[model samples]
Target chain A: MASRLRSTYVLPLLKQRMEMCTEAPYLKLKHAFKDRCVWEGTVEPSGLSERYVVRITYRLGYDPQVRVLNPPLVRRADRPIPHFNGDGTLCLYPVDSGEWTAADSIAYTIVPWISDWLFHYEVWMATGVWHGDEPKPT
Target chain B: MLHVVLLWPTISGMFLIMCAATIRTGMGEDAMASQPTTEVSLDLILRGICERLQISQTQHDLAEERYHAVGKWLDAEEVPRLLKTQVYAQGSFRIGTTVKPVQRNEYDLDLVCEFNLQKDTIENPVILLNLIEARLRQNALYADKLERKNRCIRIIYANEFHLDILPACPDPQTGPECVVVPDREAREWKASNPKGYAAWFLSRDTRPSVFGLARVEPLPDQETVDEKGILKRVVQLLKRWRDLRYCKDPDNAPISIVLTTLAAQHFVYQNSEAAALTAVLDGVLASIPPFGRLVVRNPMNGKEDLSERWDDAAVYSAFVSGVRNLHTQWHALVQRKGIPNITAALEALFGEQPTRVVAEEIGQRIQRARSSGVLGVQKQTGTLTVATAPAATITPVRPHTFHGK
Candidate 1:
């Protein structure tokens, strides 16, 4: 299932940056990337940017769960960013909106969207507003 | 004589005209002033809080799934059926006051496993505990997740939630109505009446009709279950406040049972959630005596003190202080005007994330209202006003006396 999903939809997106690992009952796709906008402070000592692992768990019947496994060391006000939930699940869009489908590439769509969400999230922490056009999950 | 008569008549007629004009003006003012300047209703604020605090439909479904999974596991053939086993929910889940967990996303579900066997037969509490554990262990699905605690078996389901199954047998003295649960620590059976307590809780006037005394049945469709009643919302809000206040030292935090008991006992039937919460908080605060241990006895059984854990002066004091702070924050939110005050008070009580979500929701509503031309701001006075199409005719006036004059 992992290979099929990767080859059919997410191949181009993963390229060399992302890796896929299958965990029983679900397929886990992982990508390690850096967001320069996310500041890592003296406590972190990793400079203004650090590598983050974004994991997307996909199962056949359920909507994919996307999480930043290694979230930014410096959280906004020491709390999860507004775009993330208590569980650290990155709520990309309203899950029920039918915006995402199995045919859609996870690498192209969800991956980039997550990066976009994190970028906007940095701004949201400062401005107290989410500028992204995606409708927040209810 | 002619001059005097003319002046008196003229003066009397003018006085009558003036009185009529004043009455007309008063009536017009009354008609036009139906809408208050504080258009952001308390109900709206309460609804927002309820939306943030109440367990979502998805969470409810997940819990239900766990409930069924457990039932199916218990019913499996591998377990010796020495007695008829019945698994059902208890506590906040049963009572419909379950709030979203503050520190984590996982829900703590309390379930009761009732065995239709006499307490005299089992004799020792350990035997009953072992029997339930053995049966649960037989199921491969549960074997890995099952854990034996002091009085119950906890099954931790993959980071989603955990179910605490408390095993019980019929109390010898209390007949079938009451049951005795095993306490591994004390090595004795503890008398409990979850069903009776649930019934009593449901009997409160504030209990919503949707909860309807259904023991373990799947909650009525989410649409039918109106969990946003004043009582439930107040409970949820209080629970969230407790979570926030005791985030660091949760062991010292007041248990939900104590809070639920006190809140429910103090609840006075009120139409508004804000009013109900205020009344409940006041009642709870008043019940805390200044000089002694704060006692919150279970309404069902006075002997079972819900606040037993709060025997420590420090713990009790912290709880009292927290409740007082919550009351102050609640007043600040409701008594004060403006969204900023309400948001700040909410943030102080619930934390930054939930408050931001609620604020965003309120903002979106305001934005939608503005785009649709339903909301307007008065430029010079800086007051919020709702816009409406001009009335075809003026509001019909009804004659009303001024202070019965």
Candidate 2:
């Protein structure tokens, strides 16, 4: 009976927009009531800069996955794309590093991280230096 | 150039003032320098464009060397006709607002070759011009490089720069410093005052004079951020925009003197180059006559109209339309928010190659700041900051590596 009641209870839809999302009018949140919520928006790291479409997906007790949706990420000649996974998702920070956690708001942490990632990504493209701090994978 | 060397101490002093201002405002110094823009600061990218536009120290030295050689050769005692001739740089080079030509690598340097002879002795203005041409032809080096223009002798230095030496004599009726230059097409003596004009410009300029550098120092490989004052930078930016608009059809382009005069006349010192440029643009637009011809009188000599060339209806129309287009594009640039958008807008205003080079430089600077853990982000907007001392509204980003799978 308790399991049946839990199944019947409908999750509440997010009534108010996230404050950060509101500040960046270009970004929007979707599937707010679902287990997995996705936020997608355009991020221009600098003034008079390239527009990048970044999508971040998050669920309870799981790490947020960030990817650049538009202007497909590609390697420059004789250079590998830095700070990225083989599947093309950005490895923004080490999941085990405790630098970011599920408790942190996606609006506050993940969104800005994506912007920073793109910023460094462009810098790497211009000069073949990965400026983002990262630990060597074991 | 010695101008850059003498200005170094002044530049350093100004930078110290900037640092103090940053501290008093309780902002991080590194952050202030790293990020391109703030509420009242010139964008780094814009500043970068000006830096790249300026001639390098080596180039300046080369131009100085070439001009000095010509001056010495003309002033030599061996030349009876050219004795005591004085050679000095005029135009944008003298004023320190030279912008490299868009179409070529060569910079056009205007020089005044003032003869000791009296202007009254010369019956025809063309005679004085011919006399200088004959004197230059004595040397095989100058003879080979020399190209005759109507009023001046141009000595081209191949890929580097070209010097346009205008022959003139002291005006007896006016001040000794003023002179009467030849008007080739008109076959008359045109009253002009280059030295007086430079003095007037310097007096109006807020920065210390770039003249009389007794002590010379080697310029640093890296250009300092606080090198140019608001007025000079604005002039360079205007000239660059003009070049972009008129490179293909240069005959109709407005003269540099006209643009320089307008900018200097209407300049109200603003903290940032961008702000000062906008204000100057507004002043220029307002100063244009609504119903009649635009008259730009030389400040030193009111009798001389700097915009005399604009008497041609086609030239006047082209200049007016070009200025209007510049004003429109500048407004649109101000409205833009991100780096990509701003770069594209600047490219449209300036040129594509220079704008891209600056954008790349700025990107590297931001990346270095990020590596040093000086990066921060505003909570509301995703705008990045290189501020080490972030305020309450900012969240300082942590250092983390991007370990690829």
Candidate 3:
């Protein structure tokens, strides 16, 4: 049972990061951009004992490429964004009295908004600061 | 002038009664008796009183007519009357500073049924489209038949202003985010729990950006017990969008040119260019106009990912320049709009205007940005001057004069 758990948890590190990405530059940029880059670093990895799971550091004016560091997909898809909390929610909904609809009519605006963030401002890039006019400290 | 206070009210009342009697004789007394004017309170009644006071030659002849037309709309029930009223024009869709013979008329307007949506309190874009479509078919003189698109919803009228009725939905959730478009699949998703969805999607779990200009709406106060937080988030979203639209893009556009420009404005005032660049870039995705194909592209593959948009270096440069130009254009355009006081405009939006003026201040900002240096470098960089964008060629704005004249 202990060996089985170790294989499940430890096999990925043992899989030797079988990808073409260099770790040196990755470590460098991770620190430089405040570790907020989402693509992680030019990874074209495959056939690791499992899918990798590295923290994603998003970038602006860039394409959305995930940093696959590990998997079982620790967190799966269609599932809420792993780190997202109802606390910092920021999506617009119908100005309706009741439940918000899933209609597609507003996609042209909202999708590009997401697409631009994804392609431009990768959502995963968390640098922990507000970029707008900050409330002036009294 | 003739000691007419009570006497003044008496004469005006007599004239109104005469007009009412004439209308009643022509139409019917019952119709005149049941209108909203009788129910209108004193505040709105002042409009007629004020119109009676205009004292101009144009007004001397048409004051009563203007009063009747305007008062009928203002005093009458809002929704039903707006339905019957035809949209004449949308005004000043674009603003630029370049001077040209036609610059005055370069803007565009879209005709809409004040609230075009079937039962929408706010404007419903689709119903306006249907009306325009019907009108074009009913009118004579046609070349290739006018085609109605569900998305763009335009009807060509008099071969001039294509009455472009753009549809916008107002959610109980108001803010720049959570906005519904023509195909967001909102009707279905909203049924589950709109407030919950809007409330959830914009929740604090999304996190903040590196700079201070952008952020996701924070968590609900039910958790923190502050309902005003939701409202504040909505307000922030609105200002962000409003600040963005303060100017239209000139040449090459940036990804979030509006947001970026506003972001630059946000940081420049604080004297931090680094924060300005990052904030402008965060939480911003490629944007698409309601009427056009998507142009924002992904940065990773350096190619088109999901949409029809293509990613190119020129497009990127345009995006960057476009954002920067927003500041330049806005400074110039608003100056022409007669808000010659940039300080006031800046104060209204950003609260405290920056002490150092950005070089683009065509309006009266006190200190303009020094055009010589990089953001952080106080020393002037000989090459770092604001690009000589095509000078705003302000062509004559074709005033949307009275229809048929």
Q: What TM-scores do the predictions have?
A: 0.61, 0.74, 0.22
Model 2 chain B weakest 10-residue run by lDDT? B1-10
TM-score of chain A of 1: 0.54
**Tens-place lDDT digits, model 3, residues B201-315:** 2342233221211112232212221221222222232233243433354233322223322232223221122222233433232233333334432221212222322245555
lDDT of 3 at B205: 21
Decreasing DockQ order of the candidates? 2, 1, 3
Q: Residue B230 CA error for candidate 2 (Å)?
A: 1.9
Regions more than 4 Å wrong, model 3: A1-138, B1-105, B110-128, B135-150, B153-163, B174-179, B183-314, B321-405
lDDT of 1 at B202: 72
Worst 10 residues of 1 chain B by lDDT: B1-10
Interface RMSD, all candidates in order, equals: 27.6, 8.2, 27.6
DockQ of each: 0.01, 0.23, 0.01
After superposition, the stretches of candidate 1 with alpha carbons farther than 4 Å from their true spots are A1-138, B1-38, B75-81, B184-186, B206-227, B376-405
lDDT, candidate 3, A1-138, per-residue tens: 001111112112111121102111232134324322322322111110111223333222221222334321221233333322243222222122111111211111111112111110111112111121112355
Q: Please, what are the lDDT tens digits per residue for candidate 1 over residues B89-125?
A: 9899888787778768678999998887877777677
Docking class of 2: acceptable
Specify the highest-lDDT model's number: 2
Worst window of 10 by summed lDDT in candidate 3 chain B: B1-10
lDDT against the true structure, each candidate: 0.56, 0.68, 0.25
| Residue B250, model 2: Cα distance from true site in angstroms | 1.4
User: Number of clashes in model 2?
Assistant: 17
